[model samples]
Target: MDLLKRRLDIAHVIAREFLGIQEKGEQNLLECWLQEDERHRMEYEEIRQLLVAGEEAWKELEDGDLVAAACWQELQREEKRRSQWWVVWYRYASIVVLMLAVGIYYFAKQESPETIIHVETAAVTPGGGKAQLTLADGRKMQLDDTIRLTFKEVGGTDVSLEVGVVKYSGVDTADRKGAYNTLTVPRGGEFALVLADGTRIWLNSESSLKYPVAFTGNERRVEMTGEVYFEVARNAAAPFVVEVRDMDVRVLGTCFNVTAYGANVVTTLVEGSVRLNRGEEHITLSPDQQGTWNGDKFEMREVDAQSAVLWKEGIFYFENDPLEVILETMARWYDVGVFYADPELKNMHFSVKIKRYENINKILGIIAQTNRVRFEIKDRVINVYE
Candidate 1:
């Protein structure tokens, strides 16, 4: 046999070994292949590990008929290409084997038949750019990714929406009494805004920002709830300030992220400088520094500041975050409710990085692989059990 045919035959033998249907001579052939080279042994070990890990998950599959039909189709194709039968067989075999390997690896880790409770297959789509803008006059306007238009604000400032962003220009700075506008992003939505002063802000799900139509007087200030990332415009004369509950973040020209959805307020400085003040206590943060105000006192730590703004880039980046915290974030982005049957499950920590646009199942599946917890979805609510 040719080199390619030999490799394909070896792969077929490996698949049969996993399924416990290998013929008598296949074991000796696999051993010979493993002994031929160190790389072969490593590859064989890797495939074996995947098969073992996914064994339990494979048993849970309910598509036996579909699998049998697919196998039959592959067999038919093999007869038509007798000269390349090994190649054709291995091509389809590898797909089936790898899919089984991946599914098992993700769903069967340390899982036992008695421990398997439930798994929901319902799909939940990801969030997108959507928000509502409230003018100073109490007029509400819906803004989404599809619509693009321009209009004048209450203070005669020109506001325009284009490509998922709202921009404010032609500011009447002379009118010192600037009218305010509140941008509210609901659950499963996010939006960006450019203030009249050229400052840029990105709001996360379930967030709202109240800012002036134009930066007037001696300072540029905004009050917000939930989470937001800011790129402040440089103006040494008028420093920018963000008010989040009891905390105040003051900066002249910088990029930073503030999370204030919970009792604690976290400010992560990406570049330039920001001073965080809560009543009498205050602290300044430099680039790559994070400060948290926990209602009573302030705690500062050095961290990867850029990671805090990953939401704006359509990425979910978690670093050893607790299950409760991660679920809370998912609740906002996926617009789903969460119920924990076991309180202890909330304290489980995990480090994960994934695209925000993926279906909720894929994200939850990553967690379920641990086998420490199981989840069931009912009417858009996720129930967790341990």
Candidate 2:
């Protein structure tokens, strides 16, 4: 028991030194001398108890954000102190060295920028491809062209954007029959639109939206594959609906996000009531509530809506989204296929907010810090390992 207590005392000092709270001194050697004396061992126990008490004080946390920050800061301070005592206590230097190596490895990973995912067919990537839109007239419009048209389609009639969101009425489509427009958002692609009803829809990568030039009935509907963020125009006479896969969402002109990429579909409402149904399961949501489904059943709960659909604004938000969800987004945005080395790693969860422009390596580095897992980017492919 004495030996065990002595070791714990030494571990407490090393932990503090590793956290960087102590000042510069003899390093590991000084730490070794302290372990030879029983009196010093007793002092070490005292210090350990103090540290334990401090940890307990933190247990009564109120705000999660503040607690996380405080915890991280305390860890950092302790590690810094541990570093100075490391050389003095050469016996305990191994732990200090290991942590330092890990921190240094993190820095090295950051220095090496990684390529964007799956933009290329192979792991060693090339460049991404551009998206093409098929207008209702069967005309293909390459978005890369210099000729930019504004008055696209608004409120079943047509309207144009003068500048930012300035409205210019569209000409009557009475000359033609019901026309369908196929808008494809290729990998690494995104765009904004003013719907026929003055609604704004932002399309993310690997997404496609099909809509008619005008609405003929009391209900407005559009087809979607992938994901979209919408601000519906208020129309009491006609409600707006989005149909994708097995899910259909009815909205009365409010803001919401819909992710119906494949078998799973998630609809999160920001403001206004939304009626969602997947087959027989139907649920109505108030603001801040989301419906999660996968063709079989539907569930509603409160969620962080921004994190659910940040892709629409050219930002990626991860609020404890699992590896599966993150990989799905990565596959869509970077246009790559993921091969798992082990099944367990696929279930790991991470929380990070990143912009689309940052290279894959930066995000991977952030992820590696939380867990022992590491990511290696080879051209267009990323290898994840624990």
lDDT of 2 by residue, 1-386 (tens): 33344344445455556455644553464467465555545544544454455444233231334544454555556676677454334323333333333334453465334322222334332113345667666887666323345645423455443222223245445644467677777876666667656888877777778876766579888888888888999998889999988678998899998887767788999999999976778999888898888657887788877667776555678887788778777767776566666768888888878886676656666776543466665545666766
| Top lDDT model | 1
lDDT of 1 by residue, 1-386 (tens): 23445666777788777677789899999899788666567767766665565534333332444664465566567767776645444544554454434434443453544244344545667999999999878899999999899998655789999978999999564464657899999999999999988899999999999998777768899999999999999999999999999789999999999999998999999999999998899999999999999989999999998887898999999999999999999999999899999889999998778999997877887777665677777778878888
Cα RMSD, model 1: 11.1
Candidate with maximal TM-score: 1
The TM-score measured for candidate 2 stands at 0.66
Per-residue lDDT, model 1, residue 335, is: 92
TM-score per candidate, in order?
Answer: 0.71, 0.66
